[model samples]
Target: MATAPTPVRHRPTITRTAGDVGAVYQFACPCGATGEEQAARRMALVDLNEHVLSLPKVPAAQQCRTPRTHGNQLWEPCGLCADQTSLFDLEVS
Candidate 1:
């Protein structure tokens, strides 16, 4: 008997780019879904967070809370706070 091949999974990547006024962020999923523009750096991260969080396929644990862009480097979770808390902390400020 032959087995079926597993499907490929692609996560969205949020990239920060400099804008005419200020820093801007654009997130694009492998499926071609794009995120909104945010003036504030943190706000941009929040937009990316919300996009991924809304997806039914992504689990709570797998969702990154404190995502940071390291000076044109890698984008990953900072592991400082939980997904829920991090969102609140960033928004409340």
Candidate 2:
């Protein structure tokens, strides 16, 4: 007799939500993981990013780079890269 194939598992999506108190936020994942309430939205975003990075088969954040516009390079780091850096810095501190 042929054996049945195993079901595939999908990664949970992480999202940020406002907390009960004003100016506070937290992140939750479908997998039942949650972040502690944070006063700064940036902290919530960092928590979400950390969860994403912990999952299997996920790609690492891209390196920071200045984008060129009309033959001139912008002075700011890419938003995604900046966020990624901030997440790591927070983790280390």
Candidate 3:
């Protein structure tokens, strides 16, 4: 039987760590996408945003790909909207 190909995990990731000169910013994702080092935190975030927006939009399967990670949340049939913010907003009060 034909099976679905392995799902390509495309998540915008920003990994930053300290270095000799200063802090190093890395814009990388599971889709094998990367960028040059960014010295500014804001710039790195911008890079991440651009990369994320450029990627193909994931269907509303109750998944969160932002910041590149398959969050531990499942799609619920609750009457709430299926937008990204409504699904992954941890600070929901």
Most TM-score-accurate candidate? 3
lDDT of 2 by residue, 45-73 (tens): 78877876665432233333534432211
Model 1 lDDT per residue over 10-69, tens place: 367778888888778777777577778766667766766776666554234333553443
Residue-pair clashes per candidate, as listed?
A: 0, 0, 0
lDDT against the true structure, per candidate, is 0.54, 0.52, 0.60
Candidate 3: give its CA RMSD in angstroms: 10.6
- In model 2, where is the ten-residue run with the lowest total lDDT? 1-10
Best by lDDT: 3
Models sorted by lDDT, best on top: 3, 1, 2
**Shift of residue 12 alpha carbon in model 2, Å:** 6.9
Instruction: Name the regions of candidate 1 deviating beyond 4 angstroms.
Output: 1-8, 57-93
- Residue 61 displacement in candidate 2 (angstroms): 19
Which stretches in model 2 have alpha-carbon errors above 4 Å? 1-21, 58-93
Model 3, C-alpha of 56: deviation from truth (Å):
2.2
- Ten contiguous residues minimizing lDDT sum, candidate 1: 69-78
TM-score of 1: 0.45
